[model samples]
Target: MTRCALQAGALYESTSITYTPECLDRLRKAFPGDFDDVDEAMRSFDPASAPAEMLSVLRSFTPARAALPGAAAYFHAKALEAIAALSMRPGPAAPKARREDRELVEQAEAVMSARLSERLTAESIAGELFVSRSRLCEAFRRVRGSGVAETLRKERMDAACRLLSAGGAHIADVARAVGYARSSSFDEAFRREFGCFPAQWRQDAV
Candidate 1:
C-alpha cells in the first residue's frame, strides 16, 4: 500500500501517468496492450503533463472497465480522480528575477530619466539594451510593479507638478517641457492623472 501510495504520488506529479515497466508487466498479464498503456496513462496522471489523447484514453478507461469489471477499474478510477484534482489545482508560480535583473531595471530607469522629454517606448528601451520588450517589461514590472507607459506618465506628471509649484514657467511652457505637445493636451492629461487641472494644482500647491 505504501508503495502504491508513493507510486500514485509520483504519477500524480506527471501530466500523464503512463504505466511503469512493473505496472505494464502486471497489466499485460490481465489485459491486452490496447488498454494497458491507456490504463497506465489515465491513472495518477497530471493533466498538464498528459497529452489530450491520454486524457481521452483515461476518460474511456472507466467505461472499458465496466465492460470487463475488475480490480483494475477500481484502481484506475481512484488514480484518475487524484490526477484530475491535481490538474485542476493551479501550478506553481514563476520565480521572480534575481538582483542582477533588478540592477538592469535600475539602469533602464536611469535611461528613462535622462530622456524624460523624449518619446520613450518599451521596445525602444529594450532595443537600446539588446533585450526583448517582454523581458524588459517583466524586469521593470518586477522592480516597479508598473508598466513602462504608466511609469513614464507618472514621472512626467511629477515633473509638471514640480514646475507648476515653482511658479516661474508658464503652464504652456511647463507642459511642453514635460513632453506635452500642447497646453490643452497637458491640462487634460494632468486632470486625468492628478484629478485636477494644472492651474488648479498650482493654486492648491500655493
Candidate 2:
C-alpha cells in the first residue's frame, strides 16, 4: 500500500484501540509534538486488553478505514514521511521568504488585524494598497492560498475565539466586537466557520 494509505490505515487501527485516561492524556499531550511516536506506541495496542472505559472511548474515536486498492508501497513510505514530518520540529534552515509577496501579505495581514471591527471589503483593501481588486486577490491567494474574504473571516473568527475564551463576553458583545451587527448573523457565521455555536465554543474552551 502507499504511504498515505498505510498511515491512514495505521491511524484507523490505532483509533480503534481503547486508551486509558493516562494513555489518552499522554497521547493528547504527545500528539502535538510527536504524533509518530504516539503512533508507534499505539501500533501494538489491543482494545481487548484495555479497560472497559478505554474501550468505550475508542469506539467513539476510531474512524472507519477504507481500502486503498491499487496503492503502491513506495507511495505509503512517502505518506509516512509526510505525516511524520508534519509533527516534527522544523529543521535548522528555514525557507527564504518571497520578498514581494511577503510584503503584500504582511500589509494585508496588518490591515485585517487593524480593522477587525470594520466591514472590510476586498475592493476597499485593494484600493488602500493601490492595487486593482484582482491583483490584490491574486497576491492574497498566492501568499495565503485563500481569498481576501476567507482571510478576513478567519481573522474575525480568531478574534471572536479570543474574546470568547476571555470568559466574560456575551455572545452578542463578541458578535459586535468582531464586526457582525446582528447576533443571529454572527451565530450563523460562527457556526459555519467553526462547526459550533458561539455559546458551545465558549463552554468548550472554558
Candidate 3:
C-alpha cells in the first residue's frame, strides 16, 4: 500500500504497506466484486492519506505471530480486512485543497470519536498534525461546512445518541462518555441537536 501525496499540514498520517502475492490473491477471492476497485486504488494511489482505521490495522500488525492457537489465522484475517478496506472506493475526487481539507476533517472526526471522554481541543488535534488551529479550522469549514468546534459537538452528540439508544448507563455517564463535562451541558446540547433530552431520547428509542 502506498500513501497518497497530500498538502502541507494534512491530518492523515502517511505510511505504506506491502503484501505478498498470496495475500493479494486471498483478497481477490475474499472480495471478488471489489477486485477491480482494488486495482484502481493501487493505480490511483495517493501518498498523502490512506483509510485511517485500515492503515492502523496494517501498522499494528507484527510479522511475528502470537503464540496463541488462532493467532496465525487472526493475523491473516486482519491482513485480508486491511486490503479489503483499501480496496473500497472513496468519494468523488475534488480539488487538491478540498481533498486535503476533507482528510483533515475525517482525522478530526476520528479523534473526536476515539477521545470522546477526554477534554480534547481542536488545537491539540492540529498540533498533532503540525498545523495551526486557524488553518485546520479553515480547512474544516471549507470541507465540512462547519467549524471544528461545531463538528466536535456534533460527533459527541452522535456518540451520545448511540449510547442512549443502546439503553444503559446513567445520563451523567452518557454525558461524560461523549465528552461533555457536565450532564446539564450534555442535556442542553442534546436538546439542541435532537430536539429532546437524552433521557427522553432513550425512552423514545425503547
Candidate 4:
C-alpha cells in the first residue's frame, strides 16, 4: 500500500512512491540530519515495528465517506489513501506492485504466503493491500469460495500441522510459527480445525 503510485479506477491506487530531488532538498532542510541517510532509514523500517497508531492516524486522513457522487468520490477517497500511505516509509519507496494484475484474491494469497509468521488480521491485510476490509473479504468469497479469515486460518493451521509432524518444535513454538499468540489459543484452533488436539494428531501420525 505504501508504494503510493496513483492508479485510476474505482479503488484507484498503485503501490508505488516517488520522491524528487527537489523535494528531497526541501525535506533535508526541514529535517536536516534525518534526511542525510534517507535510503538507509527506509530500508531499515522494520515491518514488525510499523507504528500502528501513526499509520492509523495517517490513513484516517482519507475521506471516510465518498461524498462525491459516482466515480469522482472513488478518486478523491483513494487518492488520499495513497497519499497517506506514501508517508509511511520513513524514506525509501516500497517497490511498486506489478500493474498487469490487480486481482485481489491472487494478491491476497501471495501476501498470506509471504507473511505466515507475522501477526495478521483481515483488516490489516486489507489495509496493506489498499482496499477496504469488506471489499477484500468479498473478493475472497467470490473468487476463492472462502472468507479471508477462513483462508488465513487454514494456512496457519496447515503450517502448524507440518511443524507438529516434524516433532522437534514444541506446541508453543508451533503456535508462534503459525501466527498464534499463545499455545492455548493454538490448541483451541487446532482442535477446531482438525477435530483433535495438535499433540494427539502428531502422536497418531507417528
TM-score of each: 0.51, 0.52, 0.51, 0.51
The per-model lDDT (C-alpha) reads 0.61, 0.60, 0.67, 0.62
| Better by TM-score, candidate 3 or 2 | 2
| Residue 167 Cα positional deviation in candidate 4, in Å, after optimal superposition | 1.3
lDDT measured at residue 113 in model 1 versus the true structure, 0 to 100: 79
For candidate 2, lDDT tens digit of each residue in 1-206?
A: 11334544354444422335565344333321123123333443343444344434334332232235433454443443433332232222323446786788789779879877766666677789988776665566566755566677778889999999998988999987887777877887788668999999999989
Instruction: List the candidate numbers ranked by lDDT, top first.
Output: 3, 4, 1, 2
Per-residue accuracy of model 3 over 123-202 as CA lDDT, tens digit each: 67788777887777678657865456566766777788888888869999998787666787778667866899889989
Candidate 3 minimal-lDDT segment of 10 residues: 28-37
RMSD to the true structure for each prediction, in A, is 20.0, 15.4, 16.6, 18.1
Model 1 residue 173 distance off true place after TM-score fit, in angstroms: 1.5
Global fold similarity of model 1 (TM-score): 0.51
Writing each residue's lDDT as its tens digit, candidate 4 over 82-160 gives 4333333443333343332238878887887888877776767889999987677656645655556667877888888
What value does the lDDT take at residue 8 in candidate 1?
Answer: 42
Please report how far candidate 3 places residue 125 from its true position, in Å.
Answer: 1.8
Question: Which stretches in model 3 have alpha-carbon errors above 4 Å?
Answer: 1-96
